[model samples]
Target: MRKNPVATKAPAEQVVKDIRRAMRKLHSSEEKIRIVLSGLRGEDSIAELCRKEGIAQSLYYSWSKDFLEAGKKRLAGDTARQASTGEV
Candidate 1:
C-alpha cells in the first residue's frame, strides 16, 4: 500500500517559517509614504521611527530612497508630456 503524501507533516522549522510569512503584514503605498515622511521629519531617529512603525530600518531606507528618487524625477520633468496629448 502506498503512503499518502498529503498526510506527511512538514518540518517544524518550515512550518514556523510558513506561519511567519503568512502572518506578515502588507503595507499600502499610502502607508509607505506616511512612514517615509515620518522618518524624514527628523524629530526621531530612523531606527526609532522604524521601531515605532514595526518595520526594519532597511525597509525604511528603501522607501525613503524610492520616494526621493520619484520626487527628483518629477522635478526633472521626466513625465512632463501626457501620453494622450500630442506634442505641437
Candidate 2:
C-alpha cells in the first residue's frame, strides 16, 4: 500500500498563526483618520461605530485620543521644525 503525501499537514499552531496573520487587516493612515473622525462625529455611539467597523471599543478610543492630541499639538504650534536639507 502506498502512503498518501496529500494527507500530510503542518502543525496546528503554525496553521493557526498563518490563518491569523492572513486575516489581519492593515488600514491606511487615511482610513484610520476617517474612522477616528467618524467616531468623533457623535452621530452614532462609539460602541456601535466600533462594531460596524469591526474594531474594539478600546482601539477606537485609542485612535480618538491620538487624533485629539495631534490636533492639540498642531493648534499649539508645537510641531518640530523640519530640516532644511534633505541630505542625510
| Most TM-score-accurate candidate | 1
Summarize candidate 1's per-residue lDDT along 1-88 as a digit string, tens digits: 9887666655766899999999999999999999998888899999889999999999999999999999999999897655655654
Off by over 4 Å in 2: 1-10, 81-88
- Clash count list over all predictions: 0, 0
Can you give the lDDT of residue 46 in candidate 1?
91
TM-score of each: 0.76, 0.73
* Pairs clashing within candidate 2: none
Compose the digit string of candidate 2's lDDT tens values, residues 1-88: 8766555545666789999999998878798899998987889999898999998898888888988999999999999867777753
Per-candidate Cα lDDT values, in order, are: 0.89, 0.86
Residue 10 Cα positional deviation in candidate 2, in Å, after optimal superposition: 9.9
Residue 12 of model 2 has an lDDT of 65
After superposition on all CA atoms, what RMSD does each candidate show versus the true structure?
A: 5.6, 5.0
